[model samples]
Target: MEKKCVNEKKCGSCKYLHMTYKEQLKKKEEFVKHELEKCPELKGHFKPIIGMENPWNYRNKVTAVFDRDRKGNPISGVYQEGTHRVIPVEKCLIEDELADKIIGTIRGMLRSFKIKVYDEDTGYGLLRYVLVRRGFATGEVMVVLVTASPIFPSKRNFTNALLKAHPEITTVVQNVNNRTDSLILGDKQQILYGKGYIEDILCGCRFRISPASFYQINPVQTEKLYSKAVELAGLSGKETVIDAYCGIGTIGLIASKHAKNVISVELNPDAVRDAIVNAKVNGIKNVRFYKADAGRFLTQMAEEGAKADVLLMDPPRNGSSEEFLRSAALLGPGKIVYISCNPVSLGRDLGVLKKLGYRAEECWMVDMFPWTAHVETAVLLVRKP
Candidate 1:
């Protein structure tokens, strides 16, 4: 069965969508294998890649960039593959269906309002982007209207009109980005309607997700990936756990049941706040969230002679920095479960950890983003005696 996306060439987001899903998994497995081969020490520890049962419409979030169509009418869609050119995405196979619908509805509303979209060349406009995020399990929705400026004409009428059109929308926020740069959202934000946040259930825990919160786009695969990481950690209800680069404390809070305590470190304060609220919502008392640099926090822990039995790190796609790996070595966790988005970065970081008395013992690849050339993996590392 072919996927539902039509703009494959114009919107090159789905690079591997041409092949069958099985073939996609095979190719991804080979890619991870080749990346791991760069690190000869853990070359043989690669396990069979975990795939999704049904990969369609998995993303909980979607964003539409504002651009003018050839007809000079304001349009919104994704950027073309490897180009700044806007390729209007009417639908996406990977994004949640409701999110796509809401985005379309917003675009229609913008057109109806005659709202001038920010032109990158002219720099005079109101809306820059429309970001729609839906709670996969909660049925809640949040719409972030990214504008070039905070001053929105007829704001109240526009809000009323949008809410009237889409009664399912739970919240609406306006993010102002006055700069000409390509950044989607600015630091200044105002809640135009509702509570300005949404909640979702992941791994049997409730999480509060804001516009800035780093919740996983693919919630279903994220549960599988995090579960694999927790299982790899081998938590025994007696060991302390440390979650480095823990975004909103998803991994750490989920692992709280199996561990005596979990200390999650994040650089984003907004995420840390959400993590704390999520902990309270889940009734998870054993976990604590700290807003600090993960590397610096780990370094401080090492200096204080503090140690954790289990360390779980889910770094960004660029991968872990050498300072983070160095801090991890100094922390000296008995077991380290690394959840990585990029295999090449994982390979590079593993080479660094190998010199620090840590070796990869088990590895599992989870197909988080199907149809895309992205792969997520969890690896268990044990300190050499």
Candidate 2:
């Protein structure tokens, strides 16, 4: 029998914790195959879903909401499913063990430091949320303190105490989120200690990770997922590739080693800056990054008769926009490799691509989130002659 999590029902993050690993993989495979079947042309193309050898404690990133219990004591955990109530979780099977311990230490230190946990009702207190990111390969850790305001009382002392407890922490950042919304990160940020960012190795390349970058949460499976995506591209050292929606240039930098040249584009300035630094750090010169809307940039390139041999896109969970799909078709890449987290949105976008003369050739699933319903998918589409 699987050992059930104490807060499994309340936390509601992992729906398959009770099932065996094999059962979880089978369920996910069936779920993804069913989703792809919605587009008949995409049927019979799904390869075996890749699963992790050790799925527990695979999440390198952890975010917890701050609250006070009836006794007015500080606590930290995730929000309950479909509700704003924070369910305190001391340890999570899917989260990094060190991150959990670090969060526990921070939670305990808040009371002694006279720091008040934020109350959403009256909008009072200092700390709002705590986000921790750990590099599985490098053993580097980052802690982001989400506060309601910039004025942090005894900020130095609090940081010193936290560091004293966990010297493994590489950096500490203060993110001021004064809004009433549910977003964990705010616009304003100041580095409280060390360098503001941490580095991690992915697919034999080092990537600079900032707090807001859209990096994969599970690094172990990420290597496999990206390796499959690159394999599907069939790069022969002569292909010109375009990586759209490129966050910190993870895929582009990885693909650059094989392709002749890679063009990567993203809208976020912070991400673009980090991507440039990442390229420099990795000493990769063949890939170039642009801070522009991917769809618009590709459309302009297509209008200029610029051509690419392959197009790689890893859009958000909502999937790529129709504009981006149309522009992708306009660019007329011989092959398209799409990495999607949401199967429904992927099906919808696949149908759009089908009408644009692209046919789904093969699809592979990577179980990045082991216990959760969410699964990462990579699909290869070829332009029909």
Per-candidate TM equals 0.97, 0.98
Off by over 4 Å in 2: none
Candidate 2 lDDT by residue in tens digits, 257-351: 99999999999988999999999999999999999998899889988988889999999889988988998888889999999999999988998
lDDT of 2 at 212: 89
Q: At residue 15, what lDDT does model 1 achieve?
A: 89
Question: How does each model score on lDDT?
Answer: 0.88, 0.92
| lDDT (C-alpha) at residue 93 in model 1 | 87
For residue 197, give model 1's deviation from the true position in Å: 0.6
Candidate 1 structure quality by residue, lDDT tens digits, 1-385:
7865678878877888889999999999999888877556666788888888998999888989988888977777898877788888777888888888877777787776778888887788788899999988989999999988888988889988888978989999998889867678789999999999999998898999999889999988898898889999988899999998988888899999899999999998889999999999889999988899888899888889888888999998899888888888888898899899999999988888888999788889999999999999898899999
Pairs with backbone N, CA or C atoms under 3 Å apart (clashes), candidate 1: none
lDDT score, candidate 1, position 374:
92
